[model samples]
Target: MARDRKPVKSKGGRPSREQAAEINGRILSAATTLFLKRGVDGTSLEAIAAAAQIGKPTLYARYPDKSALFAAVIRAQVDAAMPPITGVAETATPAARLRQVGRAVIEGAMKPVPLGLMRLYIAEAPRHGALIREVDRLGRQAALEAIAGALAGAGGADAIDRAHVVAAHFLDMVFVPHQMRALLGDVPDEADPLHPTLDARIETAIAAFKTMHLLPAE
Candidate 1:
């Protein structure tokens, strides 16, 4: 007797670029929520996959491991919070650029996810020294370069020193206080309590940087 042939199953439609982006967005959203709720150590790949409603293999395909995913999320948050430095000009004066950069930094730090990630980084520092060092190295390099560029463009030959001081002081004023409060679980119920107001903080930081001789005299 001849055996009956089974019908062939059709392959699923290929995901387009937009579809892929949507998937990535879902994964990132899930990761952000999970990371914030559970901390890095408590979160797992399976949990992320389940939360995102995708298979574990899909998550791995996009990010090889948990650390990579976490890093991507942090970078995304930072990019969103900070404005790009495209319009900065060599003729804008060092103080102007410094103010712009300072504003971006303050805005970036005050973002909810970024702030949460910063807290996580600090808490994990004791055990994950390498991760902390990596983050610091990248962050410091970006800040130093931007500050140095602004100072050099506006402050002439003394730009390097001035940039260093500005970078340090800006971080101290714009980020350190709020960062400490968040780390200590002292963030107020109000939205953006860490930053309070961006314009005010930026103005305050610029003033301080000028007072410290980190910016060219007007």
Candidate 2:
């Protein structure tokens, strides 16, 4: 029998933050291309790893499974399209707040990637309806939260329920028609023709929120 040997060293060390980020970027880029090209069901982890030029372990380490990876991709897609929302002063008027959030929503919905993704969601919804619903809920979450926060601030503590109601109304009023048009390929590729309508809807939503949440009862 041979003498005991030293323990085998680990094959690789942990990657630096920058390396991890770059690997994640590659995985997501590959996943996005495959998912869009083949639909969610047709894409596979192996394909994503191969396309990304990384090992299967690396892909799994970052995302446990396809749904998680799909969600990450979807979230990134929406975040890329959506405008960056920074903090606004608490004392800002409700109209100003509404306008700020409203502009972001409109601009985000107008992005080309969303339009294609919307169409894909609709096409795949029959079989993957629940997943599609989850994606939509997440995609709209930031906008809804921002709107709710502004409404809550203006409406005060007692009006939280009414604030949610106002936020829902604002979303429906501003997004429904324009988003539907975009999804159906009715909107032009170059510009959003709904800009004027968005402005009108913002004022309307603000007025409604004020009356329903902010104003004193007569």
Q: What TM-score fits each model?
A: 0.66, 0.70
What is the per-residue lDDT of model 2 for residues 44-157, given as tens digits with 9 covering 90 to 100? 898998888887877888899997898788778866766666786677765676677777777787777677777777887886678788878876776677666764675666
Sequence-dependent TM-score of model 1: 0.66
Model 1 residue runs over 4 Å out of place are 1-22, 75-81, 86-93, 154-165, 182-213
Q: Which portions of model 2 miss their true places by more than 4 Å?
A: 1-12, 16-18, 41-47, 55-68, 75-82, 154-156, 188-196, 207-218
Q: Write the per-residue lDDT of candidate 1 for residues 1-218, one digit (tens) a residue.
A: 11212223335655666667777888899898998999988999889888887787778889999988987786665445454555677777776877777666655666677777777777878877886777767765665665556556655556566677777777777656655665576644445645455455667777766777666578
Error of 2 at 214 (Å): 5.5
Best by TM-score: 2
